[model samples]
Target chain A: MATVIVHKAGLLTMVQDRGRFGYQRYGMPVSGAMDVFSLELANLLVGNDPGDACLEATISGPELEFTGSTWIAITGAVWDPHLNGQGIPMNTAVDVRPGDRLGFRGLRSGCRTYIAFAGGIAVPSVMDSQSTYLRAGIGGFQGRGLIQGDELPLGTYNALLPGNELPPGEATDLLPSDGLTLGKAKRKPRRTKIPEGLIPEYKHEQTIRVISGPEVHYFELAGLRSFLSTEYTVTTKSDRMGYRLSGEPIKHKEGMTNIISAGISLGTVQVPGDGQPIILMADRQTSGGYARIANVITADFTLLAQMRPGDEIRFTETTLDRARLFCTDRHRVIFGI
Target chain B: MKEVTLKYIPSGDSAFIIKAGDVISEEVNLVVRKLLARFEEENIPGVTDFIPSYNELMVCYDPVTVDYRQLLGIFKKCAADLGAMTLPDAGVVHVPVLYGGEEGPDLHYVAEYNGLAEEDVIRIHSSADCLVYMLGFTPGFCYLGGMDKRIATPRQETPRLKIPAGSVGIAGEQTGIYPMESPGGWQLIGLTPLRLFNPDSKPEFLFNAGDYIRFYPIDKDEFEQIAAGVADGTYQVRRTQKIDNGDGNRT
Candidate 1:
């Protein structure tokens, strides 16, 4: 049982995989890594499955001391990562020896970052997912953020699968289901350096792609136009649950503010009576009553998750068909599927 | 069987909602549940998860493994076959609750607002058999229906950040129990000595969607005893098979 010792615990750092699925009907939100693309790439660099659990840090990254030698990679958010007080590259694998401390200096961009080890986090998954839902106190490292003195057990799944855990019959359901598993113990060549073209560049301003929501017709003509045409800044009240944007108030039609509370999804842009739009995120409730105007497409989920508070963003309309194409393109990049 | 009315609406790239009807009624929820049962029975490949709500069922699928067009075809087939669907019997869970005093901070306010005595308010709330419209907001939280309008009360102006688990609250026409401590605005009337949700236990959820809850008042002493029993997983929760008369009208 190898462990990663937390030296200086970073802000809101938690273990996350793709997320917990098959439980939404039971009132559970699919809690997982904020930026899925970055997490998947980070895993790839460390010879882990695309859906392997990794440490996700918000704003500031954590300083961890490795108990054993392993290959580690950091991705998402532009942060100055340091290996034993020396700067290391982002989006690429870095070798670590026993007692070597991994730390970060400064965050250049993005709100969340991922640190993926060769075998991924060994935390026993809750409901088949290592993703943490802090509110419910379920999943991830003790269902909460990383704290100092917390020693994280690391799983050995990168280079080789333990003899007992092989075969599709024994495979567990993980977020972004992995297809890279081989039947035998063979050295899984991890990517030492990722191609420059594959990396996502974070910016202060971004154009988020979305489609009309279930109740888009309930919005007034002006509200609909304003929602697409205007620029909204991510408010300080943003987190994994939802991002309450502060900008032009997108009004609903008269007597259309409320709807029967129904099911909602990730990236649902629901507008309350106050006319302020809130983009549901990783930890949003399973269902909501507020009339929704638009929903961010699945392809742009990674792009939206990386945006920080105060970052300017505008909505661009995209059809579901086009959205599916973008999602397939993403899978091709990471999983080659 | 009632004529099923459904409209399939795409939500995002990976999911879509099957809107049963325009309004929130027992018929609509029944239809939603029936449709959900079929999907469960079919266990169609590529269709991953579902969120069955009051008047809609949100189906989440993996676009990479499933073809959206073919999935919609399966959904349409389900809708066409829905009229022949028969609902499973609903389970009635009798939950013992401690009303008023420290457990119910807003009981007096509710009574005064509704121009009734505290006893009257308690009688009205406890007498009605509430439907489990859905379980949401947090795990094991019941989105109930069938609360008598006489005891209806508005939510608190400022929601409490941490409402304790097993709290019975009423907001507008809806009465719900918080299975876990969460931020909520409903006016609380009592506390139930039951674990609505516990992952470590055999039944992770005490009750699920499409179930029924009947509240019966108990004293604080009994509440404590039951709470202790619940904590140690010793108390047997009271349950009865819902008498399914025609038209979902059970009194």
Candidate 2:
């Protein structure tokens, strides 16, 4: 069995998969990977299923020691990953041998990074998922984040290897030409990179698209205009539960911020009595009593998750049809359909 | 049949809200419950899950498999079918509560606010049958209705960092139990040893949305004994058939 020993567990590191669904009606949250695009890509690059469990690191990255040879990939943030004190590129698959040390030094951009092993992380699923919820403490590695000296068992590999597997080379070998390393040494694993054009650009400022919430009429026209026109900075209070934005107060039409508590889904922008928009995320409470202003489109959810504190974001109103189109387009990119 | 307009409003790209009415009443809640049962029977292709509340239902679906127009058409058909279906009876569950003293830190406060003795407050609370309006905010946390307005009091000025599980609280006109340890602002009036939510248990939740819950007061000694039985998994949750009043009200 393969294993990875944690040396320096950076900021917040936890195992996550697609998400835990079918339990939201019981007031249980669908906690999962914050950025689904990067998580899937990392899994695919390592020849694993798209929703395979992987490690999500915030701010910084972890230093790990591998016990057996395996394929790995790092995605999402612009972290400077290194293997055995040597620099490695992102969005590409790499091979690790026994005693190889993998770590990250500096974070250039983005808020979170995902690390995927060949067969996925072997963590017990509490509710058919390995996503760590943190608050409830019921999923992932011991239902919590990884700490120094922790050892995580890797999933057993039994699937047949692809006919044209290649051992990844330098950055120049990332293109399609002569990338295959077929019939190579057993220790030298195959590596490949996603096309450069497909890599999402992580920027400091972003304009997120949203659909009008069910209770949009509760807000005044001026308040709606201000919400769409102004740029809000992500506050420090932001977490996986919700992003508390700091900006102009979005006043209600009749000071009615409270509502009959209803189910709150991911990306629902809820405005409480304080008037600031709180965008509920993966780990948000199952339901809330605040008036929902808008919901971020599914296409931009991963982009929103990669946003760090102090990052500025502006809202743009879009129709539900357009949002659905964005979802189909994203699925095409991720699944290569 | 109630003459109610069920409006389907898009909540997001993947979810939509079906509003039964504007007010929280028995009529609206019955519609919500009936719709949930109908949807379950219909087994719509892409409707992944749903949350039924006091006056509305939030339906979440997989966009990859079903489009919004297709989902809307399915819901319309389900609504029509709901008219012909006979709604199921609401289940009745009895709750044993330890009221007043260490078991209920806010019982005296509630009594003082209502200008009555602590025992009188308990009698008023446990006398009437409570209706389960919805379950939200937390796992197995039921938003109960039918609390007598006489003992109603405002929430505490400062919320407690942690309220123990099974602690019954009163916030304004609503009465509920803390299914798990969490920060809460409701005024606690009693405690119950029953686990409202036990993931390892067969049925993770104790009460359904359209059930009836009646609380019966128990002494501290009885509470400890029941607590032990609960810990050993030998305590049987007391349940009985709710007798209907022949006027659409269940007792």
Candidate 2 per-residue lDDT, tens place, A1-337, comes to: 5689999999999998888887777787888888988998888777777777899998889999988766789999987899999999888888887789999987888998999887677777776688998877778899889999999887644323335353332332223323322211122222368877777788889999999998889999988988999999999999988999989999898868888888787799999887899999888777889999999988898889999999999999999888889888877876772
Residue A88 CA error for candidate 2 (Å)?
Answer: 2.2
Each prediction's whole-model lDDT (CA): 0.83, 0.83
Q: TM-score per candidate, in order?
A: 0.92, 0.92
Off by over 4 Å in 1: A158-187, B245-251
**10 residues in a row with least lDDT, candidate 2 chain A:** A180-189
Q: i-RMS values of the candidates, in order?
A: 1.1, 1.2
Q: What does candidate 2's lDDT look like per residue over B65-120, in tens digits? A: 78999899989887986656656566789999999777789999999999999999
Candidate 1 local lDDT, A1-337, one digit each (tens):
3479998887789998989888887788898988888988888777777878999999988989987766778999888898889999998877776688999987888889999886677776677788988988888889899999999987644333332122121122111223533111123534567787877778889999998999999998999999999999999999999999988989788999988888888889999998889999988888889997888988787778999899988999999889888888878876752
DockQ of each: 0.73, 0.60
Report model 2's TM-score to 2 decimal places: 0.92
Task: Please give the distance, in angstroms, between residue B105's alpha carbon in candidate 1 and its true position after superposition.
Answer: 3.0
